[model samples]
Target chain A: MADNEFLGNVGGRTLSKPPTPGDIFFDKSFRFLTRAFTWATIFLLAFIVYKIGGKALPAFPDLGIKFLFTSVWNSSENVYGILPQIWGTIYSSFLALILGGFFGITIAIFITQDFLPYKVEFALKNIIELLAAIPSVVYGLWGIYVLVPLIRPLANFLHEYLGWIPFFSTRLSGLGLLPAVLVLSIMILPTVAAISQDAFKAIPHKTKEAAFGMGTTRWEAILRVMLPTASGGIFGALVLGFGRALGETMALAMLVGSMSTLTLSFFAPADTIAALLANTFPEANVGLETGALMYAACVLLLITLIVNIAGAVIVTKATPGGDRR
Target chain B: MSQTGLQLPQLERQPMEPRALKSIILSAITIACAITACIPLFSVLILLIYRGGKRLTLELFYTLPPGAFDAHGVGGFGNAILGTAFMVGIAGLISIPFGILAAVYLAELDPHSKISETARFCAKTMTGLPSIIAGVFAYAVVVLVMGHYSSWAGGIALSLLMIPTVMLTAEEAIKMVPNPMREAAYGMGCTPAQSLVKVILPVAMPGIITGVVLAVARAAGETAPLLFTALFSESWLSPNNPTASLAVLIYNWSSSPYENLIELAWAASLILVVLVFVLNIISRSMGGKTKL
Candidate 1:
């Protein structure tokens, strides 16, 4: 071993170590190159966020607190505030979350439980994944034409029956917050169900059996034991779904009426931050408009960042305390 | 101690009793929601077939969007399709190598390295950045730098959209390569790079290909990024010139005031959805077969 390590060249001079064919390529230059490339990618990403945000930072010394409160958004007047867009995005996305969370959790339970035959369960799982594969544009197109018409009657009916409520008071517009909420719900459902399924499948079989052994009914076992065990995962799924709904673009842009004005009625025209950017960026005629859009982009970026970090935390906490067999 | 201290006779495990009718109703409702999530897709396909079927002849594949309402009903998505393929190809070309390298840097060399961690955070953040945000960023970077919105600019934006997904997938694929293979390679005096390229990469090729295909499918259906960077074109297909893609074309036609335009939009959307669906099925099957 010592001889092998202190090898000599063919001329018989003692050497420190013999170089192998693989190590031949791992020179100082290659190492430096690899490190440089790695750093470059990192820098490029940071630069993108910065460049998208650089101009917006200067507009508000105090991080645009007042700009966020102002209700007007008249480009010709050089007046731009995002209060309406913020309220609209949050309200609609929250509605989507509430609706999607209920539906997604229920569906997940049904598919994972023993009520269905194994073949039927497998087919349903495949269908769920395939549902996710459909393109967002297809959803948008369908929303614009078919869904809009189909829901118009419902919107009018609601307006008539529930007009006392602030959110349902407006004249029914087929394309507005309600449709957007529905689309967002659909878009987020697959994500929530898929992730929740992973969590459900991970629950210990023994625990479930024990719950059943206690003469607990199937419903009681699922509700009392399985659901709580998977709560962290269910939270992760909600956060991930929120992230997706917050950033959804073409679908929202196409269906949600692009009115920047705020209204209490969910049936009124509205604009989300994402949909606003989609509509305005293409036609941005001046620097400030562009900067404002960048500011909006930065806001979207922050939301996504928070959502992802929170999701990661929940998922990590959900990992078993270590019986790593 | 009942005389013999014998344990009470154990109760037999019973088969699950039938659920209450309400519970059955709840389960049916849950299944309906799953089906509801699929309704838009189903309705769109049915609508497309109803409207575009008669007009979706072979001639529709060879003509351009007619300028006048009645000039030529037989419109081809030739430019849009070619443009989409070309742009997606360029995006895949740019993303895969860089993304794979980033994944390798993350998993193989230093799991806790600051650079890799920062790279990972950025990638995750970018994954949730709306495609429109990416489009705006690309506009600032590519369009501003090049002095015009072009196909090249669109390609850059789509690459940005694609890189994070590819990086995440590649990292998962690479992590699945058993560490013992890497150790064996090193025992034979192989360096990390040699071990990766000669042994690890080949073992992980199926997974990597699956990731790439899925990424391409994602890029192909993206409309928001292309909107700002590659504005629509009417008559010609040019890889060098500013061009619209199938997604963008569908957007334009669907939103136009003309009925014919709307019909063409449905047709194009049908084609795009089918293309994406096929790619998804392939990648999904590949995922099942190659999963470690």
Candidate 2:
């Protein structure tokens, strides 16, 4: 009460005094820095759009919609098509999502259940987070040195054994769609696993207890009860993982062979939008080349926007309101 | 199996024979996964020490990378390290204040406003945007518009990447400052900025520093954004020049066909990883100090 008395006097001296016209005007003048900074951030976005738009407009009139559909990326003749890059980005990211979803969810389940010791679970979770800490370039180097050699024979074996399959037909090049996909899988697994782990841990223990009370086995209880309860969270995790995979650059750049051609075989040459952007943005001379690169970035940005929106929607739907501990 | 007189759930709820075995098996696999995660981190560290350890005298830190690769000779990554320090330093300078201020605005002043909400959304989206895209943005705006890629362009890109992290962490730290503290400051006639810089910032200083340190560490190890904006140099090193960082150097060398170059790349990677690891540990140590 004493402190409030003192504070009341101070606040009254500052704010409750009959508003002097000069004091109010002076305060308004002091807001210049804040407003300036706010506008500066706004200007950054505007400038970015203008720079990208100025270059992109030239190609828009002539290329129309045909440019995106065509696969040819011939530079000498000045024809650039983004179909392969777009397709590669989608294909590799999808592959990452599928592989990471399966393994990450399984691991999350293993950790959440009474499958591992407490210390082991703790250590495994830290390990996954550590994987997230390592820079993407380091992952690329590791992938090239270890993962490629390690997976080459496996890829080759798959090619030889399952040559009839469309995706497994090409000879192992050690650096192509397969390597890119595998690297992306590894990169995204930790993301998915982390999110899924949180989801699984959030499930109420009473639900599993009730399932067990019904004479269900541990696996049966998890499959029938826990999985259904956490499916929304799992979906959110997948979307987040998908976002990470789509935006990944250095690692994918190193693994994706980087030839701008669309092909069916996973072992064939491929290029992702991010990889192409990273590769060409520095070297692009001017005008259309630069514009095309920005177009590629716009596509990358769109993919991320879609991923975030989808994840947000799923997460919002999954969470029930007014449920608190 | 149900009639085998082995009622597992009814009896101690443990499968005596299989439970122990399954636990052991799961424990082993978990351990293996942890070990797998550590392999690359440890390998990079060991590689750096093995290669750089032999020439770890004072001169190694004092000289630049020699033109030719000499296996047994001593040369340094002094320029690359300095370049990295400058780039990260400039980025930190540009980003830290703005980031912390924005975070303050979001967490404290007019937090529910449409502007704050939009800012928060952009900050979050920026957090997840590819580092390469930031580089692309910088290239388009700072470099291409200016008609040349410069260190400023690289620094700006890195700053963009660093902002979202700082903003998120700072907001979190400031939000933890107990509302009564802010209320008290306001009661004493301190302006919002004053309250932030004095009361809230002091209380949140350790967390903000920790966030800043982690952000610097990430910026230090970033290779993708630097590749285009900060182009590499062999002998001539200038902060004004579009210069390369240790991480990008490592990337280039590791991918090259030359055997000795690959070793140098590994050496650089080793150093970079250790630097980041040390920074990470420092942040973790600071993060462990406070409880939410």
Candidate 3:
């Protein structure tokens, strides 16, 4: 064969060569295109803050810091205060965090600690995840139709006998903090359980074996060793769950009764910032009221950002390699 | 001392010790807590089927929703369904390509770049963003700018909520593509673009599809983002006009004083749940099969 032909035929193909101009051009453009898209994603976050903050600027000067401390929200008179909503948001989410955190951690322990057969554990995990698949609006529907009525008797009893306590001072009135908290807890359950389960699963097998070898009972080992080992992750899960509860809108709107009042009574109507935004934004007039609602949204966004970012940081740090994905 | 010259302890069978008993009780408590966590799921499912299932007729898929004061359960949510499909489809179109390309950048082109790290962190943070804030965003950027609520605004809102989910999941899928596959492609003298388009994409298709389906499902059920962006309409949907959605329809009707409207809300809830659950199952099954 000729020298040129032999060169082309080496290794059954043409010899290696630098990328052609077209190849280089296409590759460079492809990289640029992908990079552009990535930047777009980051820009989206900034855009949200800019647009929301810009709209809320007018209200900030008008309402001042008092917007967060005053409770009355008279939209018709163009006066807006979100203190009650803020209080409800924090109070309901805190209660939900406690309820959801407890059950979620326990469920995670049960599933990860060989408490059940493999198939059952897998099925249970999926079932719990399915709770998250249900829409918030449907949860609202269920809350209104089923949960409220179901809890009414207990609420009545609490009011009837324990009415002296401020928490049960008022009637259930078909919508209140109690039902909202209950639904919110249920809503955050999947987040907490799923994250905590991963946390428990990430515990080193040797750690578990060491506990067993030390003659610790299963529960003792789990409580004394595994829980501490996964404490960071579990805490992260609770924080994330709390973040989710704080932002929950439709269900809380439907169940919390949309009343802007600060009270200790769990049976009394209450409002959350998210629910307030969802309820008011539609009917809010063109200028100041809309700005106020936007301001409330800004507040809600700030809170959730702080909470979710903290939670994400904790989760990342807790994972073994400091990278969850 | 025993015959073996070791101090052999007594081997008498003993009742359960306090620690063992405590362990058993705690284990039982864990089981109880698991069951308690599951109660809400079963309750919601059973109640949904019991109440919502009763209203699931064939007409529910093709009829317009009942009027606000309609005494009879005379209409369906067909328009809302179409509107939801339109908005979610628009959101999918907008988010999917952008998300995948971003994922490509993060996972393939510049895996360790600072920009990639920032983008990844932003995406993680965005996943927890309040859906309602996305509505406010759309309201400001799309609705206020356009001077009207439009399906486009709703789509924009949903797309915001969906992009993070898609990007994160797609990045994960791309990362799961083994290193040797890329090496093989490179060894074949293929350019980076060619390799990604022809080899990496095909391998990651299943995972990408699963992510897209999951994102779409989530977008479909979101009510807060659509509440103001779409701003429910009684008429049929158009891109420029405020459009109805099943979620908003349920929200509006669930509280209606009219019994029939309430029933229609239940039916809508049922349909939404089924749609979300079906998509979830599809993604789960596809995900199971795509395990590398």
Candidate 4:
């Protein structure tokens, strides 16, 4: 066909020739295939919610909304409650967030502030990320053999000397909230640090320069100006870290002692919803007990969904260039 | 002369200002925090090596796990190793194609369409879905429906976790392809599909592979999603039977009363860690090459 020959003209452009039937068919199928894949991906989230929610529905008639508030969880008695697990999940995650968040932000500042050589910074970043690559089960194993024993003396000392305080009231047991919180903090450090590092990096260079130009010290700029500007992203990081900690199962199941209790003492044994699900699900009977466990899973899913959506929103909004990825 | 003489006595270097002291102290604190954050990593690694390394043996790679009361050197988690590989491979098969295709739609076919935007949001949200929930979902959708536990269900659970990660990363990689290349392909009278396959996908292959490797690494390490889905087995890999995996073996054995089982758990932990680390390093290197 001639270059200017056209079977159809659209948008004032001459066509060499119309697409062949085979080409047209292939193009339509290709587009349809990709669109189907995209929809399938989107449909997956909805399907998960539906399946889990439907499975959990039977529990509402038996346990009622009181399931969220009642603490006792005796399988033989047919009365199940996730109150303690819920409390433990929130409490340990909150404490982990505080410890992880502080150190994470500090590490972020340390790496992003040009304090270290570029090569050193790059190596440090990679090392921090390596923490994430280690399996949770391995952390649990190490916690049992190494961390719990290592922290026992300190925990006992705090209990002995400062026993009046609620946080340090209980003596250090073999597996308790303290080790779980510590390990959880370590597990979440990478997420918090990596996100906050991006947040700090997203700040306009002039902002830092302007602070320095105003005769401010490095600390002054970082503490007063940079932190305020990146607070949204940092908050988002903490939220996401909290979500991760809440969902963490294997490590907490091994380390938290799986004792269903509500206590302020960090040394007391506690259970989380995720840990409870993991420890109990395999052996649970296919009735009220299983339904209750599914109910708990539903609750956990709801919490994580809310937290992650909020964090994602905050992060996307706070990012300066608007979705660099 | 008088003014110079009066100022000369006061010109000695003053003591360090409090502001300078505070800055130095804060800097020290941040450096300290960074060091503190690293302590756990070193501790975990050292303990894994010191404890897990002792249990490492050539026999550990090929034997089945010892019975609970069996002697120390009787068995290994060879079944779990194979199971992990088989299930993770299944997950890769399901998610890699779906993720890359969805990415192509988002980054190439209609970058700013409403459906693309919604799909992107859904992928991001799915990234935060708890692995346990994914297991439950699989249990409901696959196990309850099929009336049995299988590696297929486990892979489905893992694919649920893997899809978002692969999709997001693949999308980023595809978008990173230079715009001029696309224009050049079209300028050469290439159709959209042809340009995508020939020009865009070739350039984006490394980044996509990096995502795949990372997703696979993550899937291999996951225990929660496989707990109820794959369950656990003592036997070798079977499509219908429950399967063992390194992560679950570590979880199950770490708590056993037997000293030998504990030792096996440590060894499995070491191997799992090394496997995940290698995958991560591979992905990191590939990612560096692609600069995505």
Candidate with best DockQ: 3
Each prediction's DockQ against the real complex: 0.46, 0.34, 0.83, 0.76
List clashing residue pairs in candidate 4.
B64-B76
Candidate 3, residues B200-247, lDDT tens digits: the string is 988998899999999999999999999999999988877899999999
Best by TM-score: 3
Tell the DockQ for candidate 3: 0.83
User: What lDDT does the true structure give each of the candidates?
Assistant: 0.78, 0.74, 0.91, 0.90
Best by lDDT: 3
Chain B TM-score in candidate 3, rounded to 2 decimals?
0.95
Off by over 4 Å in 1: A1-23, A26-37, A58-64, A320-325, B1-25
B201-233: candidate 2 lDDT, tens digit per residue = 899877888899899999998877887888776
Task: Work out the TM-score per prediction.
Answer: 0.89, 0.86, 0.96, 0.95
**What's the residue-level lDDT of B118 in candidate 4?**
87
Give the candidate order by descending TM-score. Answer: 3, 4, 1, 2
Candidate with better DockQ, 3 vs 4: 3
> Which has the better TM-score: candidate 1, or candidate 2?
1
Which pairs in model 3 have colliding backbones?
B64-B76
lDDT tens per residue, model 3, A231-253: 99999999999999999999999
Task: Point out the higher-scoring one by TM-score: 1 or 3.
Answer: 3
